[model samples]
Target: MAAGGRASGRPAKKKGPNKGTGGQKRRSLEGKGATPPAHMRHWFKDKSRSERIAREDRGGTTGAGGRAPARRRSEDAPEYIGGRNPVLEALSAGVPATALYVAQRIDNDDRVRDAIKVATERGVALLEVTRDKLDRLTEGAVHQGVALQIPAYEYAHPDELIDLAHDAGEPPLIVALDGVTDPRNLGAIARSATAFGAHGLLIPSRRSAGVTGGAWKTSAGTLANLRVARAANLTAALREYREAGLFVVGLDGEGTTEIADVQLFTEPLVIVVGSEGRGLSRLVREHCDVVARIPMQAAAESLNAGVAAGVTLYEVARHRRR
Candidate 1:
């Protein structure tokens, strides 16, 4: 026994890296692995380069099928309303919501509190998640501590626009867009249509903006009160309206008839508004029974689809009132 130590003990073995290399071997897990589980991947996430090109080839629109592709979120995905005011307004407007997300430990300000109150009152699922989760949900937009998930808007049949007027014992007054892609413009048009006694709205299933949350908010909740229909082919829809005995009026900057001089305003009509830039597509222009123009002080001036729609609706309403 040497100095009270174990007689059989040799020099103490030195520790070598504690038997593991601080997760170095596990670093492979951090890199890209196999394709993630479908449920874990967000909608439109992890798209391959070819898939992106294919989407572009499709022009980011639904095709001749008259419906968006099955995989597209616009066809079947929860609509997200981000920003405090938009969320709170949507809640107040009784927009049916599937869930309400509040950032964990978010400042309980008036908008946030009101959002929570309305969501709870309406029995929307309230979820408190981390900021990262909210960011992902909003696609990196400013959520301002709250977000709402709503179901996609259910569009009525194009015929339903006429049916509604028939049911009310009045002429059909509908607003149809040619290729307007701005959701805010859709909302504004919705608001104007509702205010001016238009029966419903008609948008093409492709090459047009749908009734998204932004449109809903821009409509100031008027969308809830209006029937919105989608057309497989806008030109075809216009033809159908004509066959159904409703006048198809197209708004263009270079039209032969001015809005004030238009004679079909009081008739059962569908107003077709083209995009601000192109005015009207050639096929869509051919489909119009009368292409009408809004007189402007400056010949070079133009109106966005929303303002043009509002102006046209105003003229229509004026004629109806007379």
Candidate 2:
């Protein structure tokens, strides 16, 4: 009985050459096809030096090389704008975009063909790249399989905006944005300007969003339909509007009168909406003929920049209709 107990379990299978533990065997198996640990895999991936520097900016690991890719100061990189409507609108607006990038395998629908024709007519370059390349260029943005490379947006001068309005017919309704940095907000305002029959959009050259691919997309092609004027100084532009015999109304939450309460259609008007977080710059506020607020529920502190501009535009249109 004692011998049986001591020599139990068929001689313990001879210990198998003391081959470490189960973990070692599992690791060996994993080595065959297992994904590298996250840290190690990141190290082996190819990335540009600028991308590595950007990663460092975000406080991410840059791997063992720690060497960033050389930065090219040239302006050769294409400006990418995603979404169908924005790109279509830009094409329609005759904005000087540099090229159009379509996925090689994208469906050649009628709309897509029309877009291609428009781009070709405008002398914009058309390039077909793999879907992966497109995705990378758009930085995983929702491109809908099409993207456009446009030159940096060229904004018409403030005087040009006024002249455009006058050329269309005097007493123009001009829409201006103050310190709104988001391209989407800018685009939305552009759309509203067109819908409300405004002649042009005036944006300050500094501290304001410029027309870009994202803005063009948000405008749903409205950017192409409306004139955009860039100003050296917003306050100066407002002053120009005043000098041009156009009434300038600034939208602010603290205004004593509501937008609806004010008469906006009797004369040529320029409606200005401020930034999302900050309303208007002090100088911009000082330049307004009247600062009006949109009536809202007490629960609402403020409206989205785009929404506020649209509402003000609607009121102007309503008065014009009357």
Candidate 3:
């Protein structure tokens, strides 16, 4: 056999251009197929001229409701608290978190250990995630190998607050916040409400602070024991409270009655606190049964919304004790 020949000793055939059957023609007889619609076609030039000129602007359209995804994350989204101490403190204070995330192979320190133990005892979800995933979950915060997910707060109706007090066989002393936008102030007021044995909280549905993670943390877990109600209209809710035989008291610096001198403690009450910037709105003041003030040494002196709430709650509790 030749050097590179096949086993049969035949020389290799050289490649050449293909030539088909010399007789019958088959596929050449077929006609051209119909073209698709311009809109359905994928090619740019094949598309309809109108479509090419006026392309759909997908920028402004968000899915069904058309609400921006950022709105979902704004006030109603579940919140995460990162860092070992924050997570541990939240757990220790009975913050009712949904999940406790521990980074994979995290350092087992006292806070992390206690957090895991307490979470386990409280029936909280203990999830193990990678450190990179934990970083994303915590949004680039200093996680320290731990993070806690807190659910969005659920609100109750204002009537439910009254009913809760009724079930407890006590006069309803609910705290109602007006124009207080600070979540921390809301939290501190909640803490004071819990401390002074108030029934629940009533806040305007809009232009007020709803419960948030900061409020939960500032409340020191006291929020769990308190119910919060939202009102579409503060004046309307106050009118309803009046109809239900609850005295509506507005705390204003320029009010006629002083907190110490006011004499309606034993009655069912809804104490309305205004914003730190503006004490009370005109309509809220008009709706209040009695507009009372906290006596300050100097008339110009003012207290924070939280301090004022605490002081007012304390005074109410003291007077009720008499």
Candidate 4:
């Protein structure tokens, strides 16, 4: 009767239809195998990458058109030589070098080797470095493998220079450069100073060339053998020299007296030469006790700085010798 439900206290089992969907199962399987969209791939490709990583991993472009910068080598760099004949000449002449650098490879060249040998003999430090090392030291200067560090030149007090002359047991014979900016001119003047037995060289600190390697080379290493003094104000220095019983003579084209006519040997004197382009500064000309001109052939308007100094020095020396 009612399927004998619970009449005998027994559990009854009922059966119903299953509600499973094949389409739902197929949809879930499709979601599991889904692929990334093309736009997503494009976005990932557009992301920024590390430069170093690109260079190492992907071979990216370098800054200089995909090329590395050129490297500089050392042998072309400048080196300094001190205490050698040239260095000593520059110092004694007051040429104003601060430090000297010598290359180790200098021993390979005869001239440089000899220069090093002498520098070592005089207790100067000779640094040895590769050509690349020297290039780094000079920072791309055309140092010719030799260079000298020079201080901002300072002038000895005019009084001190005069005193030095007196102490040397000789009359003060000083050569003053008015506006010579060429180191070669300075070197030549230094040579003349040494050869003529002058006391020292006087140069204006500003607008004047300090002793340099070019000057030293031009002096044929004679700058090391002379004394040089720099002046803050050349006119004032000249005035001081005058007060010290030294005649300040300016060499110019328009001079009242001839250099030959002046009696340079008997009195203490300071000879001044102007620049090659500009003869002399106005102030320097005014400070001179005498302005004398060197006699030259009409063919040449002026003499080279070195030649003119030599001539003047020779005349002074001749007069002294007489």
Better of 1 and 2 by TM-score: 1
All candidates: TM-score? 0.76, 0.71, 0.73, 0.64
TM-score of 1: 0.76
Per-residue lDDT of candidate 2, residues 201-286 (tens digit): 88877777877667877887677667788888788878877987888889998887888789766588888899876787889888
Could you say which candidate leads in TM-score?
A: 1
Clashes per candidate (backbone, < 3 Å): 0, 5, 0, 20
- lDDT value, candidate 4, whole model: 0.69
Per-candidate Cα RMSD to the true structure, in Å, reads: 11.2, 12.5, 10.0, 15.8
Off by over 4 Å in 3: 1-76, 83-86, 103-108, 128-145, 298-301
Q: After superposition, how far is residue 115 of candidate 3 from its true place, in Å?
A: 1.1
Q: Cα lDDT of all candidates, in order?
A: 0.86, 0.78, 0.84, 0.69
Tell me how far the alpha carbon of residue 121 in candidate 2 is from the true structure, in angstroms, after superposition.
Answer: 5.9
- For TM-score, candidate 2 versus 4, the one ahead is 2
Residues 159-182 of candidate 3 have per-residue lDDT tens digits of: 999999999999999999989999
Query: Worst 10-residue stretch by lDDT in candidate 2?
Result: 69-78
Q: Where does the lowest 10-residue lDDT sum fall in candidate 4?
A: 72-81
Task: Report the number of the highest-lDDT candidate.
Answer: 1
